[model samples]
Target: MSLGDDTGQTRIRLPEGSDGDPYGGARRGGRSSSRSLVTVVGVVVLLIAAIAFANRGGDDSAAEEGAASADSPKAAATAPSGKKPVTTKAAGIPAGFTHDREGAQSAAANYAVVLGSAEMFTKARRDAILRSIIVPDRVADFEAELDKAYTPEFNKNVGLNEDGTTPKDFTFVSRTSPIGTKVTESSADTATVEVWCSGLLGLAGESSTNPVTSSWFTITIQLEWTSGDWKIVTHSQKDGPSPVPGDERASSADEMAKAVQEYGGFTYAR
Candidate 1:
């Protein structure tokens, strides 16, 4: 008895000296095995062909969708609006945004840039900026708040003179670049937007206490349709969805100063 033999099953023993081929002949046995192999191969080939056909159909669908996307206007969710950016300026800042959600977002983003700029350190420019962007009812309050905030002590702390002037030899670098904007809430006459920003600030000089550094922040702006344009009712800022610092060589003081002088900030953003 073999290890796998079933003791309860019946068995037939062939005559002595008979060929051991189960199909009674070697040729027949070989044929039976070949047929089994062919059947298995046929099934496998059919499965592969079916899979290839399904995948090819899926590819055609995807290609058609991509072509349609290329031919038609981009969906508002995935792309910026096609409306023209504001061409007008008031008080040296971009103004006259369209009366819509996109306009609100654009206004908010540009306002964030100017509000964070070096000009805001000076009282005269800061007041002008506030008057241009803030709603009429809020302008006085905003000016008063910012007046207390950009004090002489604060200016000195950030490497500026008490009067908000750069040192004789050093160049002051304070600029904000809006990364993106989103409207969180909206209506026919009001919108609330968030502007993600990256800012450069500090003094560009070899002997300066504060070297130029980058910071990330988000500004939330509440806006209203006022005087045929969007104006800020209130705005506040919070620190960053910051990314880890990259390993790049730092520029020399002269290089930093020259770059700041040569590279101008944008007038509009969206």
Candidate 2:
């Protein structure tokens, strides 16, 4: 959830650690001091392993492999199609990904990053993003539900105006970084992928009441091959494979803002 520079390292520093619960849902409560609290609980939340499919494992390495393998990258779990990553954005989001398991995972991972981004809070960008990634029939329901969730008061809670804009002197920060992607199921016409991600949410500046902070999550996106591309049918979130709180010293708001401005996010292929 820290600022990631082109070198793939976290450039932003955490100013402080917290003693309060980090699972506070943004919609249920007013924003608190811990800007690091889980902000966008995407489509849904379920702690139980939601995908009911055969997990890859064998007795010899079963104990060492089970849940660890869930997040870890293994050669057998990934395949290459000799296809180039999508280079175009349909409505500012990636589009025309290749039709295969890798393509599906790539779409899901990129979708996860966009869905949890600051852009999704605004009406215009949100609508465009939904139209580009979500399956057609579900678009209406998703848009209505999300519109209700990202209310004017919720915008205020996240340090934005009712119209989802930041005050003149402050910089808003809501970004998601996907660490890895895994396909849980796949075939010629449909696929499901889990995108492991960490995010930053809050505003950054000297006088800011809400400071940029971090959270960890995994998103499962079910996709279908339609209109010559993969589109989301459904998505859900679950809490961490989050690393234990680190002891690294936190950085100042100025440093955080500078890093965000200097760095550009990846298009996230593979």
The digit string of per-residue lDDT tens for model 1 on 153-229 reads: 99999999999999999999999998878788999999999888999999999899999999999999999999999
Q: Which residue segments of model 2 deviate by more than 4 Å?
A: 1-83
Worst 10 residues of 2 by lDDT: 39-48
TM-score of each: 0.71, 0.70
- The RMSD (Cα, Å) of candidate 2 is 15.8
lDDT (10s digit) by residue, model 2, range 229-267: 999999999988899999988889889989988998878
For model 1, what is the alpha-carbon lDDT of residue 30? 81
What lDDT would each prediction earn against the true structure? 0.85, 0.81
